[model samples]
Each structure stands twice: as structure tokens, then as C-alpha cells.
Target: MPEVVVITGGSRGIGRATALRFARRKGIRLALVARDETALAAAADACRARGAEVLTVSADLAAPDGPERAADAVVARFGRIDVWVASASVFSYGSVLDTPDEIVDRVIQTNLTGHMRAARAVLPHFHARGGGTLVFVGSLFSQIPGPYVAPYVAAKHGLLGFTRALRQEMLGHRGIHVRIVLPASIDTPIYERAANVTGRTPFPLPPVVSADRVARAVVRAARGGRAEVAVGAAQLVTRPLRFLAPRVFDRFIWTLQRTLGLRHRPAADTTGAVLAPMHDPGAVSGGWSRVPLRHPRSRRR
Candidate 1:
């Protein structure tokens, strides 16, 4: 029997790449969940081509019930889930003062609460089955903290905390594992969208890691039961700096923001990038404005 893996936010960016990586593994069944039906179908098709059983579900993780529904669908199709990866997250760039309340809510819901929902939804099954692997796609910001992306920073930190607590709870249980993958910036649309909103350049993190790099880490953790992995040397440095010299690091961040003119500015809608505030309806463009997106069919193949 093939091992079943359920992944959220599998339409694009790291999620899509991760799905493809897993597809190459022999005897792995993959279920990809995303809001874009078109993109989900495409991702599923690509995975299917690799000889894996693939299922695609169009779901908005930001919604309260979406994660449960996605989980149910995965379980229904696969009978059992051997792995769960919470890869769905959104970012809003700007100062804490400039970001709208709704955007904050959405970021929290999608990045933090949504992840919790998935964990809770599948944990019982994992526990009943005597073991499972839960992988979280955390960010470097979780440890280092980034200015002008306060929401993302907060959500990542929350995710780290959640992962730790979950791991502790699952400890001593045979066959159940929880771990996190922290990576520095990769060349992805998420960065472009964030840069577009924040009016900042997406530059290479010192020893920046690629999405594929993170995907490999995920694969190793899933197969070998590693507890946690950080993908970049940049993260290796900043993770400690954030703890030992938080104030100093924060000051440096503020200086960078000031030097870069990255203070809250309205994003231009022309870039096809999403902004914060209204997260559920979907991606938003321009400053202080949110564009609601209806769940679309899978668009990535």
C-alpha cells in the first residue's frame, strides 16, 4: 500500500514544489488542497504523472471549516493519512500601524489558526493509527523577525510555538512525529507579492535556500523522522540573533526599513499581487485595499 500524504496550499510556490518532490517517491499517495481549483488540478495531474495516486481539493484554508473539510476529503479518499503538511500561509507587508485589522485577522487565521485546525483535524486519526508525521512550513521570520512584515513575523512565531507544543504532546507516542522546516527567502511568487506590497526588494538572504531545498528537508524529515530542520545559513545566524540581541536586531531592522523607505505605502494594483486585511475573499492589490478571490479551479500543472 502507498503512503498517503496530505498537503495544504499545494497550488503554487513552495507547496507546489513540495508536492512534485513527494510525487517522485515510490508508493506515495498525495492529496493537494488549495483555493484555486485550476491550480490544484494541475498540481494533482503533475503528481499523477509521477505514478502516485493524486487528489486535488479546492479549499480556502482561511475559512473556519475548510481545513476540516479538506482533511475529511483526504481521509475519505486515502483511508489513512501517513503524513500531513501544513503549507498554506499568506503574508501582508507593512508597519504594524498601517496594516488593517482585517488583514491581521486573515494572516493569523491562515498562517496560525488554519494550521492548528489541520493538526487537530488529523491528530485523532494519527493517534489512533499509532503514528504519523506532521510537518510545518515555518519561515525564517519566525526566529529572526522581519520589519514591515509584522503580521508574517507574528504568525510564524506562533507557528513555531504551536509546533513545539504539538511535538511535546506527541512525544513518547510511537509512529507519531511533528517537526518544522524553517527556510530563508526563496525565489517564489510569495516574495514578489510581499515585496510588491511593502515596496521593498526581495534580495538574497545570506546563503538563501530554495523552495526545493526546503522540500528535500521535508522529505528527509518525513522519511527519517527528523525533529526539526532549518534550511539556510542566514536562518542559522538570525535565529540566535533574535534571541540574544532582540532589541539590537529590531533596531537594525527599523534602520533598514527607514533606509529602504519601506514604511507603510499603498501597494500598486498593477502587479497582480495580493495585500493584507481581507484574506478570505482572496488576494488583494494596492494599499489598504483587499481583493477577494473566489476559489478558482487548479491553474498550475
Candidate 2:
């Protein structure tokens, strides 16, 4: 039987790249899940073009039953799931007080709770099958925080903890694997789809990499490479800065936020994709300059 993979948020960014990566291989089946039907179709078409069997599930991970429904939909079609890459997430750009309660809640729901829900939805199948992999695409923000985007950072921090705890619990199921890929900001539609209440435009912290970079890491982890994989060199640099010089870390982060993270021009406040999905089916890249250059967005009306 072919390897059956369920990828949440597979229509865009790291998830999209990961899907295509897997599609290039032989005997791979992909289930692409996201809120946009158009986007899912677009992604599935791309994967199919690459020679992988594709199923697109249009579902929102933030909804209470969303993850379960998506999993059920995939299982109904594929019969079994070999790997679950929980990569569906949304971004919000604003200070804690500036961001509305709903937006904050939605970000946590999508980024953190969604991953947890995905695990709940799929682990039973893993136990039944006697082996499977769960790969959560996390962020460097999960380890080191910056100003603005508080909800994303907090949720990712929670995701890191969730991964650790889940890994410990999976000890009984020797064939069950839990992994996290913590990449420094990679180019993705997330910034473009983020809800931005802050006047300044949101951009990724510098040293931006392609979504393919993270996709590669996701692929490796899914194939039982490592429990925790950090994608960018900056992901390595940030940790020591946080631990060795806490005060310097704070100043450095603030400076980066002020200069690079936020663009010079002011942006309109819109709840980009928090309340809903973007109109575009989306793509593998955010249209940002690749690594060795960089930047990082909002809610829509």
C-alpha cells in the first residue's frame, strides 16, 4: 500500500511545498486540508500534476469539529493514514491589548488547539495501524518571542510543550513518532493572510528562507529523521541570545521588530484571515525575497 499522508493547511506555504515534495516520490497519497475549497483544489491539482494521488478537504482547523471532520474525510477516501503533518496556522499582528479578544482566541485555536485536535483525531488510527508519524511545523517564535504577534508566539510555545508531552506519552507505542520542525520565518502567505490591527505592516523577522526549506525539514521528520528539527541558521542563533543575554535579547528583538519586522509604510487594519479564509486559493510562497534578505500582516474585511 502507498503511504497515506494527511496534511492540514496543505494548500499553502510549508504545507504546499511539503505536499509537492511528497508528490515527487512514488506511491504517495496526499490529503490536503484547509478552509478554502478553491485553494485545496489548486493544491491538489499541483500534486496530481506531480504524479501523487490527491484528496483535498476543505475544512477549518479552528472549528471544534474541524480537525475530526478532516481526518474522517481523508480516512474515508484513503482507508489509512501513515503520517499527519499538522501545519495549518494563522497569524495576527498587534500588541496584546490592541488585538481584539476574538482574533487572539482564533489564533490560539488554529495554531495550538488545532494541532492538539489533529492529534486527537488521528492518534486512534495510529494505534490501530501499529505505527504512524505526527509532525507539527512549529516556529522559532515558539522558543524566542518578539514584540507584536503575541498570540502566534504564545500558541507556538504551547505547541512545543504539547509536542514534548505527546512524545513522552507515545513511549508505549514504539512505532508512533511525534516530531516538530521549528523554522525561523520562511516565506509563506501567512503574513499576507494575517489579521493586522497594528498600523505598521507585518513582515517576517530577517534571514527569511523559502517555504521549501521548512518543507524539507517536515519531510525528514515524517520519515523518522529527528524529534525536533530547526530549519534556519537564525533559529540556532536566537536561542543562545535569549539564554545568554536576556536583556540584550529583549533590546535586539525590539530593534528588529521596529526596523525589519514592520514595514515603513502604515497598513490598514483588517482581520485578514482570522474570521475567514483569503479569497485566493494561495500558493507555495508569500512573494517575499528569499533568505539572505527578508521582512513578515492582517485580518480582511
Candidate 3:
């Protein structure tokens, strides 16, 4: 039997890259879930070109029944699901006070609650099979929350807590594996799709890594069943610094937020793609590679 994997938010970004990565292995089956039907079909076609079977399900993960439905669709097409990647998320860019309540609620619903629902929907099948892997695509913000993205930060933090609790709960289920992949700023379409109230275009912080880097980490965790893996040099460096020199790290983060995270150009306060499906179904890269990298101090200057 081929290994069957279900990836939420698999239409683009890290999820899309991860799908392509898995497709490299012959005979693997992929079930991709996301809101855009056209995008999902396109992703499935790409995976099919890689010698893997693909199933695309168009569903809004934010809806209460959405995750369950996606899970059901996967099980129907493929007898067993060996891996479940919770990568569906929405980005919100604004201070807590400035962001609308609806945007905040949507972020929590899609990022946190949706994953929880996905876990619930898959755990039974995993237990029945006697073993399976759960991979959660989190962010470095889960540790050191960034400024101007209050809702996104909150959702990621909640997701980390939820992953920890789930890991503990699955302790006795010998074969069940729960893993979390935290990546630093990567080149993804999330910035373009984010709800921005920050008065300027949102972009990933310095030293932006490729989405393929994060995708590789996700695949490695699935194969190895690692408890948690943080991708990117920036993410790995900040982890220890945040623990050793708390005050210094706090100051550094604040400086980066004030200088590099936000821009002064005027931007219409639209909700971006959070509330609706994107018409374009963007490619893997967000064109961040063209943006010159700048350090915190340089940004301040």
C-alpha cells in the first residue's frame, strides 16, 4: 500500500512545496485540501506529473465541518491516511487595537481551531491503523511574537500550545507521532494575502528563506517522527537568545518590528484574502528574494 498523506492549505506556499516534495517518492498518494477549487486542481495536476496519485478537495478550513469533510474525502479516495499536515492558516497584519474583530476571529478560526478539528478527524483512523504522523506547520512567531501581526501571533501561540497538549495525549498511542515545524520568515504568498491594517505593504522579515526549505523540514519530520523541528538559521539563533538574554532579545525584537516589519507607504485597509478565496492561486515564491536583506540596525538607520 502506498503512503497516503493529507495536506491542508496544500494549494500554495509551504503546503504546496511539501506536496511536491512528497510526490518525488514513487507510489505515494496525496490529498490536498484548500478553499480554491481551481488552485487545488492545479496543485493536484502538478503532483500527478511527479508520479504520485493526487486528490484535491476544495473546502474552507475555517468552517466547523470543513476539516472533517476533507478528512472524509481523503479516506474515501485512499483507504488509509499515513500523514496529516496541518498547514492551513491566514495572516493578519495590524496591532490588536487596529485590527477588526472579524479578522481576528477568522485568524483564530482558520489557524488554530481548524487544525484542532483536523487532528480530531484523523486521530481515530490513525489509532485504528496503529500508527500515523501529524505535522503542524507553525511559525517562529510562536516563540517570539512579532509586532503589527497581533492576531497571527496569537493564533500561532495557541497552535503551539495545542500541539504540545496533543503530543502528550498521544503518548500511550505508541505508533502515533505528533510533530511541529516552526520556520522563520519564508518566501510565501501569505504576505500578499494577509489582512493589512499596518498602513503599508507587509513583507517577510530579513534573511527570508525559500518555501522549499520549510517543505523539506516537514517531509523529514514525517519520515523521522521528530517531536519538533525549527527551520532556518534565524529561528534557531533566536531560540537560545530568547532564553539566555531575555531583556536584550526583547529589545532587539522590538527594534526589528518598529524598523523592518512595517512601512510608511499608505495601503488601503482591506481584509486582503483572509475572508475570501484568492482568484490567482499564487505560485510558491512571494518574490521576497528580490527585496534586499537588511539587518535590524540598518533598518533603523
Question: What is the C-alpha local distance difference test score of each model?
Answer: 0.72, 0.89, 0.87
Segments of candidate 3 deviating more than 4 angstroms: 294-301
Best by lDDT: 2
Tell me the deviation in Å of residue 166 in model 1.
1.0
Candidate 3's TM-score reads 0.94
* lDDT tens digits, residue span 130-186, model 3: 999999999998887667787888989999999999999999999999999998888
Cα RMSD for candidates in order: 7.1, 2.8, 3.4
Question: Which model scores highest in TM-score?
Answer: 2
Better of 1 and 3 by lDDT: 3
Candidate 2 error regions (>4 Å):
290-301
The per-residue C-alpha lDDT of model 1 at residue 262 equals 45
Candidate 2 residue lDDT tens string, 56-154: 898999999999999999889999899999999899999889999999999999999989999999999999989999999999988998789899999
Candidate 2: deviation at residue 91, Å? 0.5
Candidate 2 residue 29 Cα shift, in angstroms, is 0.8
- TM-score for all models, in order of appearance: 0.83, 0.96, 0.94
